[model samples]
Target: MKETGQFEVYVEVLRAVIIAVIFLFLLWSDRKNDLKSWDGWRYILNGFFFLTFATTIDITDNYPSLSKFYIIGPTVLEAILEKIVGYLLGSILLALGFFKFVPLIADYRREAEARRKAEEFSKNILSSVDEGFIIIDENYRILSANRAFLESAGVEFTEAVGKKCYAVSHHSEKPCYESGEECAVMHTFQTGKPHNVLHKHISSDGSPYYVEIKSYPFSRENGRVKSVIEVLNDVTEKRQLEEQLAHSQKLEAVGQLAGGIAHDFNNIVTAIMGYAKLIKKKNASIEEAKKYAEQILLVAEKANSLTKSLLIFSRKGTLEVMPISVNDIILGMSELFRVVVGRKIELETDLLDEDIMIMADKGQIEQILLNLISNAKDAMPKGGKIKIKTAFAKLGETFIKVHNLEPAERYALITVSDEGEGMDDETKARIFEPFFTTKPVGKGTGLGLSMVYGIVKQHKGYIKVESKKGIGSKFYIYFPETNEMPIGMDDSTDKFFSGNGEKILLAEDDNHIRRLMENCLTDYGYKVVVASNGNEAVKVFCENDDIELAVIDYIMPEKDGLEASKEIKKINPNVKILFLSGFSDNNIEREINDEIKNAELLTKPILPERLLNKVREILSKEKELTSLDSDKLH
Candidate 1:
């Protein structure tokens, strides 16, 4: 009986020990799997209490009733303690669980708020953009579009939603497919890439529209494209501006090239023309020789006209500004305008006021009037009225603001209006470009308006035109007005002024020009000492005392005309000096003013007549001074 009881107790003890070891292993495994929270630990502690209760039952079972009482008493007390411990642990576990979940709830709330803010920001950005925007799906369906995009297509968003992109926006009969492959959205969908397309679209009002479509793909992680976002921009104005820029650049390049070459060529042409004129004058009886010389003169004149046009294009021509009445200029040009316009066209002049004046080069202003008149005549192939109107305009802030410039007090406004075939808007925009002519080939070089435009700009003036198809054209020329009297040339009081027996030292590089000049001066009863270069001119002028004037070429070997003039003036301060240069780059006028007090400046190719007149004028002035000195001495 004792062995039986002992064996039963040992079996129970071994079973309890095995159960406790299994529970401990389970708790360790839960902790390793990151379940070390209060719930996992509570479950583990409950299992330990259950194991202790089983061991106590097994230990007291094989003992006597009294031993059982001893086990029962502690066991009951242990059960009470275990229940209290379990209650307390259960409360702690609940608190830990609540604490661990709080941060996740706050994180979820923050994520939701951030998403709302991001959505609001996206809506604001898309709404405020000037360009149109459209979002399309991978199947070429319109998913979303902004207000601008809807307005651009002349359709509402509700009406355009879920519609095929090609049908709604492009107004295509068929769906966008791979064959044409021109649509940006379709291309992006087909190739899973971004694409651009520039095409003309028509609005609901049937008006043509220019749009640039850029489509980029929104792709999924699995290498599949989800949707295409099409960004549409209305580039009509931008394209027009770019074209204008290109045209302007082209004209500027050509004008600059022509201007650079004109200066040198004009000098060569002037020499040729001067010699031809001289030959024609000398050999008048020989009709054949005269005709040939006249032919040469004709060619030179043509060349001179070309150079003048180039000068106008480059805005390089010198301005001899003088205040002139606008009314007088219009009246003076009436007969010529009539002849040029012919009897077919009526020329009307509406001169505003006699007092309206502009400080401008008279000849250039005449040319401007001529070009405008000619253009008007050409426009009126079948007879029309051409009106020339002049008026005094106050250049207030209104006018200034239009051009982003300061206001002027007053301006002389000259308008040339013609009731003829006017230009279209496109033609009007490009009319001022050089060599851009509507006239047939060989009829015009297209430089007329360009020359006019350049001249007006160079004179600190402005010109604008208003025209319409088949109605009429009007050109407004605004020249700054000056409150001053007209400056006129002083008339000489000398009796048909001729060169006297005064000796002139003439220096010219060209032999033919030098001899002709010398002969012309000699024939006019004046002796001339000729030199091929400036050095020789200086040597001769230094050796002689009766040199009444020194006419020197500006550019020469060994010594320049300026140096020769300086040396001559050092010897005789009273000596009259004149310079002749081919181009304006030598600064002859400025140099003369700076170096010599009262030196006269001249440009070459010098005409015999002009040369003679200048020589006579200077000699007469010198003789007057000499006589005045003699009178003082007496």
Candidate 2:
């Protein structure tokens, strides 16, 4: 293959050129998708080395022939290969460096977007919260304040940013930490923990505010305290509500105690009054003795009134419901009211034109009026005018808003007004609470208005109070109105009639009660037979077949009043039955059927006069029954 040196050199040069071109093509042939980072760059570098090695071998094998032409011809192939190798190496190194570090650039972009979103969320939370917030640096300088905090402090947020906390708030000459009285922010920074404190702050209007502050330490990376974040809350209204709840609970407990004692005392007073009346009647000829008995009775009656007042305060008294004209009740109490109010305080009355009937217990209603009148008189101790007015009232929407009730159909409006020093809003709010009195101890029990409130509520009524500090007070009692008339004895006439010889059967559980009834009826000229139990009374009546009246204790043992009444009616349907018991009217009426309820009811500890009147009335009516019975017998 060796020929002339120059020819050989020329062949080598051509071969080197071919090798260099092939290597360049190989690098260009590696496409964008085929470029596998550093590994693909390494393959391109190895191809350049192989081309250089082939060019060196061609130049070495034809050295003498290439030197004959020129010194450059001999190494020309080597020099070209060397240049190609150097350029390929530099390109491979640049590609490998870019591929290795490009991932860090993508990560930096992702982190920048996340940080932007977090900052936006933080800004939204700070702007919208109702409560105030403040952040302070470790040196006790304000770092930031929210809109709420700035508004509450009466300053612009920008103006407060770099000011010391105490300078802007308390107007202190130095920082709160330097003054050293346990500032919440300073404490949080010092301990690197949270500090909670309740404090008073004066608002822009000079009104005091109760605020709760929670401060937590904001720490740096090296565990050093940097700042404090504080959250503020206004608790003024909440504190007032708690105080009101406590006052209400105190009144309730006192009412319960007072009511329990009153209930028990009522029974004792009833017994005392009954025995005293008996004494007075029996000792009529002994004038001094009779007078003493009557005096005792009077004292006991007064005590009964007091007990009734206590029961009303406790809301424990049972109401004896009856239908009565409001006009009549007012008329009945007017004279008594005038006497109590006396000459110093002027008394005024306004009665409705039309008769207004209401279903209520008469004694309770009377007591309610009397208490209000007494309170009015006391309010006007220096002798002012007192007015009592009654009318038909229908509640309106405006009334409902003030009184917290739905508008009602009709009401019996009773307004009691006095020209005396009135109450404030605070006093008015608590006036109806039991045992809450402005008067000194022993002067008032503070139960007057509370009792009024309880009774009115129990009757499905509402009351409103209006008063000013210097002007007088007016109390409006709105009692529900009814059209039904009251059915009961009229005690206006004191006349007692001797009975017309009608036979009667009296059934009583208590021996004393039985004796009292028998004596009262026997004195009135009626043939009276006494039975201890309902069973005995029923058996005796069935055996005799001549009983005209059957009076049975509704709650008695050994055949109750209702059962005995049914049996007696079976024997003689014409027999009149009267139920007597101390139990509640509801308990008796609830268990009894409608057919048996037609029997007249008499609650026990029966008044002697009431007993006599009922007996006389029954016998007078039985005269019509006797003829009917005679017809049936024939």
Candidate 3:
């Protein structure tokens, strides 16, 4: 029994030692893992309880006195109590371990799910945005890109991943910063602040596009910049529209200037032309004097055409689309070109043997020649030669596409080439844009090329410019060739007629013009009734009941020509009236009443002969109508 008791004690000692060792190992392992958690402490507490129980059992069995201390209770009850205490302690320890570890596992699962949700939300937001979004790391490598970014860059996920941002965006081997371009991403990274810049990017198809880029610094938890988030917005069309609006405003400003000059200049031209005609008529018998007077009249008519061109440029004139000979126009302006370009510059023309006929406004066509020559002259300040040539061309599909013209059309090709300091690609690109000029401020209105472009388009034509820096420039204007006969080509007949003993009413604002018209009318043997303005003309017309015809200026101080004509028509429904204007027919139509009848339009500056002939024609028609009415009454 003693040996057995000693063996049992040894067994308990070994068990206690093993329990202690296991507890120590668990504690050391927990500490190694840096886990000072409540679960680890609970594990140590359970181990300690088991070790203490083992020690207590060994001590009680070894000492009979300690055993007898529990002898007060029944032996069976004592044994039961011992077992119950052991079981209850084990249960408590197990419950504590369960409580400690289970909640930790649940919390870990919840945190993992929440993190997943956050990542998904971030990806969804990035993908749904319209503007291109890209994330780049500090090494300038693409970390991630959204759908918009991928679509804009024209690359797929597999292709874009692991590529450098600069390589993907600009196809550059180095970063944009290294290439001397403004780099928003680099700026954001260096400053740890957002940056914005406008950059020109080339698309996948090698087309140049403009983009506004905004780069925001993406920071780590420790507040260090880790990456950059770039937002790219395509602004190419926006920039173009802004430029167009600015050009339109500039054209408006120039139109106002042209309109004011034209109004004042027309009166001067009318007086000059009238006096020249009067001089020719007075010196008709003397051949030498008559020749000089005829020369003066010709020059005055040319000046009148120039004033008409100013009105046309202002968009206040109508387009008179008649069949015109381009060669005749060029030849007619040769002397003027020489005078305008000076003696240092040489003017040359290569006309076709046959005239190239085109349906266009003669004055606007002249304006086009003037503008092109003027531009050429400015280019050759040090003196160079300009050559004007004409040819007939059958434009093919390729030419039509390049020139934005109708496919497979015939055009009268007018080429104006100059040997002068030419322009670069950038300048040539914007040459036809309004308010774009290389001339110094106040030297050029910048509307010359724009006007030429407008006129060409208005006449169903196209213009192309070819130029190289330090070389020369060539402008090719193409007008659709026509087969119709040219108007005003038959000028051999007499344009003058002596007016019968008939009364005429003339309304003019300028005193000199009014006097010239009065003298011209009286010299043509017509009874003249003069008025300074539209209101005065109406008064004079009502007083003279037998007035044969009324010629009225469209624009006047009080009550314009249309209003005066309306008042005159109320008095006599069959009254003959003619509307004269310094402005074009389109501009006159805007102010004139369409209801006015028995009215004809005549544009100024009208020659004295044409005016007399028109009056005679109208009177002759009125006389035939009166004779028919008298026959019907009899």
Index of the highest-lDDT prediction: 3
Model 1, CA-based lDDT: 0.76
Candidate 1 per-residue C-alpha lDDT over 1-634 given as tens digits, one digit per residue, 9 for 90 to 100: 7787677567657855865685586568656756534444555455455544444543323344223533455555644554565456445544644655566578779999999999989888888887777887766788888878888678998988898877877687577554354788777777888999887766667977688889898654578677888898988788889989999978865765566456647776776767566666755567766666766766665565556656667764555578888788888889999999999999888887566877877767887999999999999999989999998877767666676432458888999999889999899999998777888755556778988988788677889999989999999999888788986655542223467688889998888888888888888888888888878998898888899899888888888888888988988888898887765543557777898877887665466667877888788888898899999999
Candidates 1 and 2, the one with greater lDDT: 1
Return the candidate ranking by TM-score, descending: 3, 1, 2
lDDT of 2 by residue, 1-634 (tens): 3667557767767866866785576557554435445444555465456544544544334354455545454465745655566566545544654654466457667889889989888877887886788888976788998877887777898889998877876678886557655578877877888998887767667998788888988655478689889888788998889889998977775665566456547766676776566666754567766665666656565565565556655665567688888788889988999998989999888888988888887777888898789888888879989888998888887876676653457888989999988889999999998777787655576777888887787676788889887789999988778767678787633555677677788888888878988898888888887778878988778666677788788867798778888888988887888777664455566665475745777764466677877766776677767778899999
Provide the clash count, candidate 1.
Answer: 0
Candidate 3 C-alpha lDDT tens digits along 1-634: 6777577657646855865685686668656855535664666477457545633542223343234445465445554555466556556666666676777788889999999999999889888887898888888888888998898888997788789998988888998878889999988888899999999877757998899999998765467789889899999999999999989986776675566456546765676666566656754557665665666666676676665655555666567688889998998888888998999999999999988889888878988999999999999999989999999888777767776664435789999999989998899999887668888755676778888987887776899899988789999999988889976655533556888778999998988788888888899899999998989999999999988789998888898888898899888877889888876655466545466756787777767877887888888998999999999999
| lDDT agreement with native, every candidate | 0.76, 0.75, 0.80
Off by over 4 Å in 2: 1-335, 338-362, 378-385, 397-411, 419-443, 454-460, 468-472, 480-503, 509-513, 531-547, 556-576, 594-598, 616-634
TM-scores for candidates 1 onward, in order: 0.51, 0.47, 0.55
Better of 1 and 3 by lDDT: 3
Give the runs in model 3 whose Cα sits over 4 Å from its true position: 1-289, 318-322, 331-354, 361-364, 382-385, 395-409, 433-435, 441-447, 487-494, 590-593, 631-634
Model 3, residue 277: distance off in Å is: 15
C-alpha lDDT (0 to 100) for residue 272 of candidate 2: 70
